[model samples]
Target: MTYKANLTQYLSNEFKRLYEEPFNTDVTVQVGEEGHSKIFQAH
Candidate 1:
């Protein structure tokens, strides 16, 4: 297979694994103005 195809396959498998068994962690993202921004999280 081509390099691009192999890379795509690898990414696909990684996403599948992540969806099937995700990490038990929290992530926070703040968008917009620093103080006025909102925080988003996935627990």
Candidate 2:
């Protein structure tokens, strides 16, 4: 499977594991260049 597809599956499984239910909410992942972690905002 593709990276995004795998990520989506992982997110769903994780959400379910935590909440004991399926993940129905939308997800958005923003990637950046190396050393750009500082630019991303914390959720």
- Candidate 2 has an lDDT of 0.51
Tens-digit lDDT string for candidate 1 (1-43):
9999999999999986775343332322323444423222233
RMSD of each: 7.3, 11.5
Top candidate when judged by lDDT against the true structure: 1
Deviation (Å) of 24 in candidate 1: 13
Model 2 residue 30 CA deviation in Å: 38
TM-scores for the candidates: 0.46, 0.46
